[model samples]
Target: MKDKPWRREQRFYSFSTDLPTRYADMDTERHVNNVAVLTLHAEARSRLHLALFGRDEWLARTHALRPAKLQTDFLEIAHYPGDVAAGVSLVSLDPHQYTLAIGLFQDGACVGLQECRIGHWHEGAWTQLPALLLDRLQRFGLTEDVQ
Candidate 1:
């Protein structure tokens, strides 16, 4: 037999947020669409952005983080009548970019896993991460209590 592409996962993240599942996110098959899952990841990432960089600066785009690449693996189906939580972890760091892994969890199970690379943008160009930004990124972890 050929090697399996996906395997069992045992990973956690630093930040997490409960996300709403709406009728709009469901499809005819009664499952959340891939597009909706991607949106959920964005929502979680936006929270991280707000935490690391402040709301005003994030909104004003004084510094920006653009998604370079994204990949997702759907593991289970998420049902309604409850909220799902996206757990985000900063996996790797570079001078100008970083990688994040997110787990979409519902009913105590991870429905999906997402990995994305985000690059810094400043002065209309992708720039290296500043000292302050890098320091902040390195300090993030799952130390805070989770609900």
Candidate 2:
């Protein structure tokens, strides 16, 4: 899916964190690898989830929040030796699944945009999101963007 018009704006994200680019994250071309850029988004999302749900609870619910899908749009090349500002915003949510929008920025420009859908499951079928978890998600979600 395409990113929203406001996805590149840092203010659009409710959660923002800076991650340092490592030499290993660079490719032979001297640009940060695409996979490494995705990894930055993963770290950002993890931090957001951890902040929404404390350590103990996050661990307990880890198995249920399975990654259902991931779509990434590479916007620009990110060079090494600089920090990438990773931002995450909640895009949509339902009883069984929710979508997260992530943007990776370097030198104040958006380098990539990614959307991840997480499905909540119990036993062998889709399950409703826990009351507490849902409440926290709503609270931490981007007010104007959450659906």
Candidate 3:
């Protein structure tokens, strides 16, 4: 299988926003605080999830997918008052788990990247993955070979 691109496939659901760095987002050296990166990740992921699974889906599902782990890497520093373009992608799909990637870009350059592993609860416990959600995610462009 071909390796998935570092970026999300265009067909997959995506959410973009201009995230403004606030005073609290800056540190002693006047750069965007490190914690802000995680905030951006959360925003991107939330937007994507809400878009794919509407509010009703959340209320109706017995066990919804939740983030099991997150890994983030920062490539550059962004200062307060600056705005970043954040985007999210569903990159991998499995029977019980899926992977999502998010990117923060400034001035057309990527400054940060994050990947998350998500899992669903089944049979009274959380499992590796769920086939039903995987199939639904595939329609949004996630694939087995994404990793």
Q: Pick the candidate with the highest TM-score.
A: 2
Which candidate, 2 or 3, would have the higher TM-score against the true structure?
2
Expressed as tens digits, the lDDT of each residue in 72-119 for candidate 2 is 999999998999999888888877788898888999899888889888
Clashes of each: 1, 0, 5
Clashing pairs in 3: 95-129, 95-130, 96-129, 96-130, 97-129
Model 3 earns a TM-score of: 0.74
lDDT of 3 at 78: 77
**Alpha-carbon local distance difference test for all models:** 0.74, 0.85, 0.69
Clashes of 2: 0
Per-residue lDDT of candidate 3, residues 53-97 (tens digit): 666764455355677888887877877788888877676776777
The window of 10 residues in a row where model 2 has the poorest summed lDDT is: 138-147
Q: Between 2 and 3, whose lDDT is larger?
A: 2
Error of 3 at 63 (Å): 8.3
* Displacement of the residue 11 alpha carbon in candidate 3, Å: 12
The TM-scores, one per candidate, come to 0.81, 0.90, 0.74
Of 1 and 2, the candidate ahead on TM-score is: 2
lDDT of 1 by residue, 1-147 (tens): 002222122245667788998888987888887888888888888888778878876676544778888888788887655688887878778788888777788877778887788887887888887777677887773232222
Q: Where is model 2 more than 4 Å wrong at Cα?
A: 1-3, 145-147
